[model samples]
Every structure is written in structure tokens, then in C-alpha cells.
Target: MTRYRTTDGKEDMKQKVHWFGAAAIPLAFMNGLFFGGYALRKIRQYWEGGPMD
Candidate 1:
């Protein structure tokens, strides 16, 4: 495993927090949509014996 070290620790953390904040919402939404669709497809497959792959 590799460790990432930054000279400006506080600034680095702040920047990382900002990036995460900006990305979290869309990422969460997309993940939810993708998993929801996947679950629905799986349910359909289980009930109707539809092809899932």
C-alpha cells in the first residue's frame, strides 16, 4: 500500500472536502438510479424468468 502525503495538510484536506462535496450528490444520485434499475431487472428476472444477462 502507498501513502499519500501532502506538505500543506490543512489546505489539502480542505480541497479534498470541497471536491467530495461537489461530487457526492451526483454520484449518490447516479448510484441510486443504477442500483434501482438493476434491482428491478433482477426482480423481473426472478418473477418472469426473463433473460438478465
Candidate 2:
């Protein structure tokens, strides 16, 4: 494994935080969208009076 090192500790921390936010925001948004879509589908099925399986 390769270790990434930076000369400035604060900068390293900032970079890590930035990277985390960049990755996490899109992941969370996609997850929310997936669940939201499922919820909407279930709602539509209920509206149609269909048996959920």
C-alpha cells in the first residue's frame, strides 16, 4: 500500500474533508433518489389498489 503524505498537516486534513464531502454528497443524493423512487412506486401501486408483494 502506498501512503499519501503532505507537508502541511492542516492542508492534508482539509483535503481529506473536501474529498469526503465530494464523494459523500453524491452518494447520499443517489441513495435518497433510489429510496424516493421506490417510495413513489409503492405509493402509486397503493393508489391503483394493487396487492403489494
Candidate 3:
């Protein structure tokens, strides 16, 4: 689903920022800082590591 991006695509990025921003901020606060930070770290780890254990 590569966009090829023949047009200006800032709106798409902004849209995503808005969506995830809505969920991630308060959700992270609810979960507390340590767990929230660790979860984000693990997500980045998995992203780089091809989802392997």
C-alpha cells in the first residue's frame, strides 16, 4: 500500500498524528509512566526485529 505520493501528503501524516495522539497520550497516562514507556520501547524493538521473540 505504498502511496507513491505523487501529491503533497502532509495531511495524511497530520491525520495519523491526530488519531494516535488521541489514543496514546491519555492511555499512556492511565497506564502510568513506566509501563507506558516500556510498552513503547518494546513496540520499537519488535518493529526493528521482525516480530521475533
The most accurate candidate by TM-score is 1
lDDT of each residue in 1-53, candidate 2, tens digit only: 22346777433433334566568879999999999999998998999899666
Residue pairs clashing in model 3 are none
The list of candidate 3 runs beyond 4 A from truth reads: 1-31, 50-53
TM-score order, best first, reads 1, 2, 3
- Between prediction 2 and prediction 3, the one with superior lDDT is 2
lDDT of 1 by residue, 1-53 (tens): 22344776533333233566678899999999999999998998999886857
Worst 10 residues of 1 by lDDT: 9-18
lDDT of 2 at 11: 33
Question: RMSD of each candidate?
Answer: 7.0, 6.2, 14.5
Q: In model 2, which runs have C-alpha deviations exceeding 4 angstroms?
A: 1-19, 51-53
What lDDT does candidate 1 reach at residue 25?
92
